[model samples]
Target: MKAISYARYGGPEVLALGEVRDPKVGPDSVLVKVRAAAVNPVDWKAREGHLDGLFESAFPVVPGWDVSGVVVQPGVAVSEFDVGDEVIGYVREDFLSRGTFAEYVAAPLRTLARKPGNLSYEEAAGLPLVGLTAYQVLSKVLQVKRGETVLVHAAAGGVGSMAVQLAAHLGARVIGTASEHNHDFVRGLGGEPVTYGEGLGERVRGLAPEGVDAVFDTVGGDTLRVSANLVAPEGRLVSIADVDVVTYGGRYYFVRPDPEDLRRLSELAEAGVLRVHVSETFPLHRAADAHRLSQEGRTRGKIVVVVDWDAGAEGGSQGV
Candidate 1:
């Protein structure tokens, strides 16, 4: 099937729109005919060999994790879904290769969840990775409770935006850091906005003078370090962006797929407690453009690649 793949780890330039063999369905897998897939920073980072230490990728890797599609076939062991079921999944496998940036992906049941009936395929595609990251950070790592003040850095971003909405829905007083341009956007998501940069702590403190109950950092490095000073005495802190957060006694998380958590996100979406924003979309063949936009680090929401393959037509098999 036609897909975007990289022969070796490198930049977006290394990505090519081509055809590769369809992924084989495994026991406990569901073969999905992808309608849309979202781009995450990890996708590009993996492409650049930054994640090579973690995942020994095979060459000619299709790069993506977030997917929304219809099930074409379900493996023998799978019972949760059937053919023609609409689903969204964080399809990160133990290794790289069989990915969501194609017309088909064999998604393990562990990573799959029913897509919210209220959401469009693009919106559903955008949710799995970032939504899980935000939800897990708040509910699991931070344990943010009602009436607490939570400060999220880069809160207008993909994960951060979801964190803002989830934190607000949890009844936490949400404070989000973003550029001046995104302050209104953050406010609409129920967060009080603070511009991020030098004196970020002071700005956040200006709103909650006693320090916030928790800090969620999606932009790491200096932003993570600076926010460390703003955590209240009883506060918890977590960073999905920084490894150095450990130095500050904060937990750093790499997202793991949990079917239950994914289902909860879908529930939240269906209930209007969580919403996904797809700021832009590219056709599947234009995946490199999606990666380049994500690399810029300024997109306020998710970027999705729409796979417009026709089921009745012959799938492309041009690039071997």
Candidate 2:
């Protein structure tokens, strides 16, 4: 299979496209014919060895976690999905040795979920990691409720976009930060857009007037620190940007992917309650370019890599 990988930790230039062997499936895993995959910050972070301690540092690592694919064959013990069901999932973050940036990947049944009927392969591929992260931060970690106000930093980002929609669907007024260009886009997604720059705190204050109930910071640095003061008493502040900071409450780092969380997101998306935004698409071989664009910090939403778009599939082009 044609794939992109790096033999060492470095810049995008280190990535090379070439052929690699297919992955072997374990008894608890399913071998997926990868149709589409999504690139997250973790893809670049892992390529640079930023997560060396959490995940093994193996040379020639294929860097990607989000997958939207079709099940080609299920392991002997697997019963959650059949051989032809379309599925999407967050591949093994527990071990970075294997990844979804290829023609095929073996994913555990626990991380896999049925793709939302309303979403396309490219769209579903973009949902797993970022969607799960947003769901966990807002639903699990923050526990946002109706009639409250929540502030989401980097509101136009991959995770931020989903976070804004999820928070709004849960009945919270969402204040999201993006540049002037994405203001309308954020508004369309049910958020009051605030430009993230100097005087961010003031802008958020002006929007809410009353204090913010929770602050979900996907962009670390001052966004986290300054937003801390804006939180209501006993409010949660979850930061996925991996910044070290002092706060009265909230969790840091992208938490582990949870099955129940993915299930809820699936139902929400299927029911038209949750929305996914996919801003760009690249071929699987261009995984390097996908990483470059993501690291540039300008994409409005998730970036996806299409491994194969088979035209013979049921509804349309099922990429697997």
Candidate 3:
């Protein structure tokens, strides 16, 4: 099958499209014929060798983590799904080496959930990584409560978009940071958007006189440190960006993906309480372009890569 692969880690130019052997499925695994895959900071980070400490890789590596696809084959021990079930999931989290950048990827059954019927393949592909990140930070680490005020940085980006929507759905008053152009988009998602640069503290404080109940930092650096001061007593602060150490009421967070959290996010999407925003979609051959756009950090939402083995295909890949 044709897929995106990298011979070495460097710039986006290192990524190339070519034919590769399909992966083999293990006994508790399901072999998915990937229809769409989502690009995250982690993908580019791994590609550029920025995550060498975490995802040490050899040559000829496929570099994507989130996918929406259809089950083409089910391993002997996998009773949870059949050969034609549509699913979306993170391929590997315990180790960041194996990912979902190809036409086929094998993943454990527990890591996947049924794709929402209301969403297209691109939208489903966009949800897994960022959605799980947002869900875990708000529901598990922070324990965000209704009537609380939560502050989210990079409010117009992938995780930020999901965070703002989820926080609002939970009945929490959300204060998010994005550029002036995204203020309307954030507000439409039920968040009070503020410009991140300049006096961010004063702006957020003006919105919430009492102070924010929790802080979710998707853009670290000064934003994380500054958010520490905005947190109310006993407030929780979580960062997926991993840029700086964050302390809020003596609490700090580094986000990780969990199968249970993915399941919960799937439930939320199925129930119509969560919505995914996909800003762009590219063919597998254009993986480098997708990486470049994500690296710019200016995209409004997620970027997806669609795999089209049959050039003239009329519809989305089978069940997905």
Candidate 4:
């Protein structure tokens, strides 16, 4: 199978498209023919060895987790899906390797969900990781209530964009932090935009003089520290970016692969409660270029790498 992989930890330059052995399916896993894969910051961070302490690595690692695809074969123990069922997944394992940036992936049943009928493969691919993160944090962790004022950092970015919409859907008044250029985009997502930087605290305070009821921190470090001072006395704070959030009475969260959660997100998309904006897409062979774009950290939404199965067929072969 053709896929993007890296033998050693490094930059985007380390990623290369090449033919590798096909993934093996397990008893509780299904082999999915990948149509699209979404790039998240963690993909590049893992390539740079930044997550070394958290996950065990197997070299020549395929670096992607979010996928929208079709089930090609189901494992012996799996009955939830069969050949040709369209699906989306955050196909993460306990360690690196066997990822979604490939022609196919062996996704565990726990990570798989039906693709939303209203979304394209590219848009569906972009939803799993970011959507799951936002859903878990807002619905379970933060428990944002209606009429509350919620602050979301980086509202134009993937996770932040999803968070902004979900918080608003929960009936919270959302205040999102972004650059001046993205204020309109943030507002489109049902958030009141506030430009981040030196005057961030004051700007948020301007919207809710009593301080916000919850703060969703996607930008850590100084931003996280600043967010602490902007939350109301009984409010909650959660960070997906930095563990240091705990120092300020906040919870640091990590998104997990939950089929139920992914399914709910899909339902929301179908019902028009959530929408995923795909800012750009690259073919599978140009995944490195996609990585470079994501590394810039200024994308308005998600970046995706698509498998050109039609192009492959035109070249006289369909299977990679």
Candidate 5:
């Protein structure tokens, strides 16, 4: 199978296109034929060894987690899906390697969900990770309610965009932080946009004079510190970017692969309540370019890497 991988932790330059052995399927897994994969900041971070302490690494690691594809084969113990069923997944493991940036991936049933009928493979590819993060944090962690005011940082980015829409859907008045250029984009996502930087707090205060009921911090460091001062009394704060949030009476969250949650996201998409904006896409062979774009950290939405199966035939035979 052809895939993008790196033998050692490094920069985008370390990633290369090559042929590798096919993934082995477990009894509780499904072999998905790759159609598209989404690039998240975590992909580049893992490539550079930032997550070294968290996950065990396997050499020549395939660096992707979000995937939209078709089930080619189901494991012996699986009955939830069969050949030809379209699916999407946050196909992560406790260890690195066997990822979704390949011709196929052996995804555990817990990470798989049927793809939403209304979304293209590229859009669906971008949903699992960011959508799950926003859903878990807003719906479960913050418990945002109707009439409450919620502030989301980096609102034009993947998870932030999803957070804005979801928070608004829950009836919260959402205030999102973005650059001047992205204010309209943020507003389109159902958030009142506030430009971030020096006067971020004041701007948010302008929108919610009493301070916000909840703050969703996607940008950490100084931004996280500043967010603490902008939360209303008895309000909540959560950060997915920095663990230091704990010191400020906030929770630092990590998204998990939940099948039911992914299914709900799919349902939301089908119902037109949620949508993933695909800002740009690259073919699988140019995955390194995708990483570079994501690292720039200024994209309005998801960046995707598509697998061209027909192009694969000209390069080499696929495992499936």
Candidate 6:
């Protein structure tokens, strides 16, 4: 299959577009014909070897985790989906190879969920990782409740935007931090947008004088450190951005594949309560450009890589 891969960890220049062998489908996995794939910061992070000690890495790695497409063939033990069923998956496995950047991914069932009826392939592709991150952090880690106020750092980001919507859908008042340009965008997603940088807590307090019930940090560094002071003593704090969160009595989170969690996001999308914004789309061969854009750390929504819009069952063959 045609795919983007790197022989060694380095810069975007190291990525090469070429044909690669198909991924092996385990008994519980399915081979998917990828219509689109979404780029996340982790893609570039892994490409630069930033996650070397974390994910088991190998050379000639394909770098992507979010895929939206159709199931072409299901493994022997798989019954949740069949041929031609539309699906979205956060296809992160135990290691770093056979990613969603390719034309096909042998995705395990746990990572695959039925695509939301209201979302396109690109939109669905954008949801799995970021959407699941916010869902898991709020629903599982923080346990946000109705009428509570939740603060989301970097609210305009891929994950932060979804976090804002998810928190609001849960009936919590959302306060999101973004640049002035994104204030309306954040508000459109049901968050009260606050400007970032110094005095962030003071600005947030100007809206919620009682202090927020929970803090969700999507941007690390000072934003996270400063937001810590704004959370009430009994409030929960969760972060996917910083390991230092643990030092401040917060839970450091990593998103895991959960069909149930993803299903909830799908339901929310279908119900018009959750939406994914795609900032840009690149052809599969231009994956490096997508990585570069994500590396800039300025994107308001998601960046997607389009494989074959009209992909077919025969095209699903990946040398398996």
lDDT of each: 0.90, 0.83, 0.83, 0.93, 0.93, 0.90
lDDT for model 3: 0.83
Tens-digit lDDT track of model 4 for 182-228: 99999999999999999888888888999999999998999999999
Per-residue lDDT of candidate 1, residues 80-194 (tens digit): 8999999999999888887889889999999999999999999999999999999998998899999999998888899999999999999999999999999999999999999
What tens-digit string does per-residue lDDT give for candidate 5 at 1-320?
Answer: 88888999988888888888998999999999999999999999999999999999999899899999999999999999989999999998899988888889999999999999989999999999999999999999999999999999999999999999999999999999999999899988899998999988888888888989999999999999999999989999999999999999999999999999999999998999899999999888778889999999999899999988876522432211
Q: lDDT by residue for model 3 over 124-168, one digit each (tens)?
A: 999998898888788878889999999999999999999999999
Off by over 4 Å in 4: 313-320
Q: Candidate order by lDDT, highest to lowest?
A: 4, 5, 1, 6, 2, 3
Give the poorly placed runs of model 5, Cα more than 4 Å off: 313-320
Task: Residues 175-248, candidate 6: write the lDDT tens digits.
Answer: 99999999999999999999998888789889988788999998778887887888887888888989999988
Q: For each candidate, what TM-score against the reference?
A: 0.96, 0.93, 0.93, 0.97, 0.97, 0.95
Stretches > 4 Å off in candidate 2: 247-249, 309-320
Whichever of 4 and 6 has more TM-score, that candidate is 4
If both were scored by TM-score, which would come out higher, candidate 2 or candidate 6?
6
Q: Is candidate 2 or candidate 5 better by lDDT?
A: 5
Q: What are the per-model numbers of colliding residue pairs?
A: 0, 0, 0, 0, 0, 0
* For every candidate, C-alpha RMSD to the true structure in Å: 2.2, 4.0, 3.9, 2.8, 2.7, 3.5
Query: Please, what's the RMSD in Å of model 3?
Result: 3.9
Tell me the spans in candidate 1 whose CA falls farther than 4 Å from its real position. Answer: 310-320
